[model samples]
Target chain A: MQDQVRSNVVEILTQAIPSLESKDSFALAALSDRAIELAAVFHDEDALGIALVTYAFGKLVSRGGEEKPLAPMILLLQTAVNALSSDDNSAYKKSIQRLTRHIQMVDNKINLYFQEILEKARIKKGSKLFESGFSIAAVASLLGISQWELARYVGNTTVQETQPLHTLSVGKRLKIARGLFT
Target chain B: MKTLVFDSGPIISLTGNNLLWILEPLRDAFHGTFLIPRSVYYEIVEHPLVMKRFKFEAYQVRQQLEIGVLTLIDDAKVAKLGDELLLLANNIFSSRGQPLRICQRGEMEALAVSILKNASAVVMDERITRTVVEQPASLQKILRHRFHNAISMNATAAQKIVTTCKNISIIRSVELATIAYERGLLDKYLSRKSSAEERSSLLDSVLWAVKLHGAAVSEDEINEILRIEK
Candidate 1:
């Protein structure tokens, strides 16, 4: 069962890859890394991680390039629903319900381990996020780290060496600083 | 005056344990400044505010800001210093081919602030950042002892990290709490209904929770602290 679901996820992500932009693919890869690590840690053969990964991938793909249906992602979701429903093409409503519930359970577990997995993933993916043009604070939040934790990674990241973007200006920070201290 | 820069984790750890109250007396007796970098502010304040569960803690931290217990250290000099340190530190890590992002912008900012202000110490609860700053050797020690790494590094690269991280003093929230404990600030917060022994256990419990939340206190260290003659 795990092998079946893993194959399904690999097929779906590979098919969707062509349609994705670079950063989207990069984010997908991060999610894939997380799923693989979780699978290894839990020694899970049931592909619970894959189901969660696919659902997360679907969400990321859907979030990109607004308005359009993201046809590949829709197709992927439909394929997952069909696979999850055990070939019951007729039970459209019931299959949708099962898919939703399964995705939810996977989501819950993903969030449960988010702090643990993302802490490790930050080593590789932090630079990826920076290279993909996320600001220090943005990447830090995405990785579930404090800006202090993310700062050290930013130095090693492959971000384009432009002037570092300011979330708060020096003058503004000082004003707030003085107000707090005085 | 000597300065102590705080990272978000220690703030969260202190506040989570309902021990933010200790900072006031800690500051009074220490006769130093408590600085919060802008990036740490974003983590403990701006980002967490969006989450329902952390909004209260965020609010409490904000109150500290307003009352002058925690001062924000955002300015041109500090920001520029922070950027330089970020590049320098990260370069050292990647140079070793480890590519481990051992510190974040806020931690870098904290270090930069400590350096620029001629501060006394960087108060942080994070083990990785502390190891990178005060003891790069410990990074290899931890990796070998705890996490078995297959990759190896050249001696020159390791030396670079050590040189770059020199002269940075690292302290943890546990130490600040210890200060508060000695000053009798912790006793004020303890339950009067409990006996002296129970109160001591309660203090240990607080230390245990902070350690669990990344206070840089090892289990052995915490056990020793608990067994200390009080």
Candidate 2:
């Protein structure tokens, strides 16, 4: 992992650990956003793992996962933070994987819901990357989403309207195109 | 030979709108080659061929390639220049002291081919790549808006890309549809005795279709096109 990504992971995990303890939905939501920011900026798998786990935790807290079930998930997050702090990449990866698996084991319903969240997050972040000046094809490839999905998402957004128009007018471009084709 | 290089977005947009069939007629009209770089081929066809959801779209694009409506260009020079441009583009912007990796090879490769072939224009619907080629300042503003942070630019790299791609023209699938409409190629879809209202409706529908399917065209632009056509 890049040092920047590592520092970001550690920072987010440090904030997330306490938020998980008190079932603070607001903080978790913020942390989830930060994790996603890191995921989008770095396009790193570790950042993506942290994002997925953060989102899953947010969902659990919002839906009222019991304290007992949430305890182990928090511990796994701590382990992830410790692993990163100690510069142990292997341990960090294991903790992230275990964290995800633990979430899935929490309940069958939440497991299904987590899958939905994962897909939605991918699409959302993919669209953000597109908005941030990545090509649709590149963003789709990075997030493992489809151009169809990214395009549909982008079309609905104000991306087209917000973009600075090319200096060439529509009339001029149409004329140039007409000349070419004719 | 007259040529137009294509990135994957326009092809995907056209395919999504069931307008892939228009390409053959347009190419016939242009009397030029329509080329897609290798990475674009993988994005639109090869990679999607294995995915159940997009397999049909992949096959539709593949059919165009097999029938000579589209050709693939994959050479070391294109690949090398593409990698160079990819590096330059991804490094053009930085936030928090880390450069953002914003572009992928598919679009870069297509752009590289366009620069090398000196093609008429690159047919693409994704706004970012077009912005990079046409207006780097706008891209800087876009990144600033999206990230809301201290975004910085490598002016040298930005200038390099601008100079490298200065002559390249870009058109989208929306334009292709419009050109097809003007050429009366889309007339077959209209009734035998279509009125002006019906023709306007056809134009509006096709324009919106490309927008909804992922061409980076706005409602105002579509309306403007309608007004101009009128």
The top-ranked prediction according to TM-score is 2
TM-score (chain A only) for the predictions, listed in order: 0.31, 0.84
- The candidate 2 chain B region of ten consecutive residues with least summed lDDT is B134-143
Evaluate every candidate with DockQ and list the scores: 0.06, 0.61
lDDT of 2 by residue, B28-132 (tens): 988999999999888889987988978999999999999999999989999999999989888889988888887788889989999999999989887777777
Tell me the alpha-carbon RMSD of every candidate.
Answer: 13.6, 2.3
DockQ metric, candidate 2: 0.61
Whole-structure CA lDDT of model 1: 0.55
Q: Output the TM-score of candidate 2.
A: 0.92
Instruction: Report lDDT (Cα) of residue B83, candidate 2.
Output: 95
Q: lDDT at B116 for candidate 2?
A: 94
- Model 2: how far is B199 from its true place, Å? 2.7
